[model samples]
Target: MTRNIWTFITCGLLFSAAAVHAQSADIIISKGTDKTTIDASPFGASDPAGRMFIQVLTADLVRSGWFARGAQGASEYILSGSAGGGGGFVAQCRVAARGRSGTVFDRSYRGDANEVRRLAHEAADDILKALTGRDGMASARIALVGTLSGHKELYMADADGQGLVQLTGHKSVSITPSWHPDGDRLYYTSYAKGFPAIYELNLRGGSIDRVANYAGLNTGGVVSPDGRWMAMILSRDGNPELYVRRMPNGDPVRLTSTRRSAEASPTWSPDSRQIAFVSDMSGRPQVYVVGREGGQPRRLTLRGSENVSPDWGPNGLIAYSSRIGGRYQVCVLDPRSGDVKQITAPDADYEDPSWAPDSRHIAATRSIAYRSSVYLLDTLGDPPVALIDQKGDWTAPAWSPGR
Candidate 1:
């Protein structure tokens, strides 16, 4: 189909690949700064759902970088709550500093039995915000592409891998799932048409539309945080390069011109003024950044022989997967200092690192024995937590910016 026709189809449709390889590393736990200890009191004395709420909330708090699980022995804070209301599940949660300092959070959440976990997540987010002065990712969702049913399909789950929902039934190769700035819509590449084409799926309305179906390759479509442009990789102009197109409909503006080098995995900085992408212009795949308005590209990584899947976090850290000692591990780079810190141990190959909105934690794919699963790694301290326990090869996790 012609480019014009495809654009028309995408507009009418309303919406939207990453490559994967198998490798292995060791899991190394690093001790960093001390974490705040919070003692969590039990909730819901008589209701089973209330107890479930406390369990889920405790897990969320532990997964959050700011708090560690412990008893009321010398804890900095104490989280106590109760669940009641014979008709439905009602959670009354409160977080207070030890020694009668004050109550940071005192709120009540009411929901049906099916929403017990969600209610707990909401309470956890509020408690985090009240205590740490930072937003919590407990209520956020993550879009991922996995091969669970023998074919690559798009799937989504809560940040903790609960409330799993399958977004696409393409039964074909669907990859590179990206979230709209609003987090209610998603864009991904599906090969159901015998070629890679970008499609958009609306989570609220259950609708799917083709966003970009150009001739060559139409993949890696990430909507800018400002929701005004989309940075994607297209080869219609001869070589696979990064291009930024205005939202809804606008002619794509070519941003990179590395003649023989192919660019993949384009991510926008928090301010939306620059984009970090993967290119092999120097004979090996590495991360590079270029101005959003199209200018000379600047190389970012100097150590890794192969650095790809760059994700620019909201807190100004660029997290990417770097090949070290022949194994791909998650590493974060300070764009301003050129200092790099490897987060994952050399136990298993970790790739496709996506940062949470807080920027202190990262979600990436951990592969071992050729079996892949999504894992959440805290950049501050603590070990990586496996987000999903299901049996599937989950890869390319895109974390939402919280509701």
Candidate 2:
């Protein structure tokens, strides 16, 4: 068998339906961290909406790996809010620092009475940006592949796994979902036509267009951050290699000319000039970076046996999975310093790491023998949190860009 994009296997395991967790944002996780501690005042526990708002907001903050909810007076920042108004869900939130004389952020967010989770997500992102001056991922969406209807299809949800909406009903196997730069569209590969073809799915209008229907492998399609070109793995001429083409029906520019080795999983740099991808040129699979103008490919990973699925974040760090022993673990690499760090525990089998918009969290696939679920892993050493609780082997998570 030729080793290529389709040769990769996550595990041929049976699917088990995961129990639906309580849909409300009411649970308060009891984990403490040494990160900057923040706490909230009572948001009218009598009002269910109020309780839910605080819980969801605090949970997002904790999951960012930067803040931990603490006691009223023991934290660095205090969050107070009039959670729900008489008729609607409201977030009249105020964040006051311990020593600062004025509040850090004072804003009001209002939405429908039933959309408490949505309101909390918006407010959490606002508070995170106001405090740290960094982009918040709480309000972003994640696109992934699921096998709920006895076939691989597209599924999307909020950053916290709320408002999960299945996007595709093709009843065909779909994989390798990559979000468009505008965040309003996704590029995925589907076998609906009996062969691997790349299609673009527009989220706003629910329209699908065929982007690549080449002779051989047509997969790993992604748009550059600058929105000028698209990159994918194509084997129309020969073995699967990396190609970049101008958007809107431009001719492709082949970058790799290897006959014995196959290339896959291409990720663009923040500047959209360099692409980091996986290849088997050195015997085993490894990561290599090449310029968009077609130059020499430089090896990036020497610490792992099979390093694949590289996602380059705007913060300039690349996150990927490293095979250790019999299982794969999530790891981060600093291309500037050539240093590597293993963020997640090595015991579990985790792969297909995708970076969140904030660059602090990653969406990855965690396989447990016979089942797989999308999980959230913090780069700051926080424990993994399952993104989707409802079952059916979710994999190939693709995080959308921040607005």
Considering every candidate listed, which one attains the maximal lDDT? 1
How far residue 277's Cα lies from its native spot in candidate 1, in Å, is: 0.4
Q: Each candidate's lDDT (Cα)?
A: 0.84, 0.82
TM-score of each: 0.90, 0.88
lDDT of each residue in 185-280, candidate 2, tens digit only? 999999988899999999999999889998989999989999888999999988899999999668888999889999999999999999999999
Off by over 4 Å in 1: 1-30
Off by over 4 Å in 2: 1-33, 85-88, 99-101
Check candidate 2 and list the clashing pairs. none
Position 85, candidate 2: lDDT = 51
Record all residue pairs in model 1 with backbone atoms less than 3 Å apart, i.e. clashing. 16-198, 16-199, 16-200, 25-346, 25-347, 25-348, 26-346, 26-347, 26-348, 27-347
Backbone clash tally for model 2?
Answer: 0
| Deviation of model 2 at 202, angstroms | 0.6
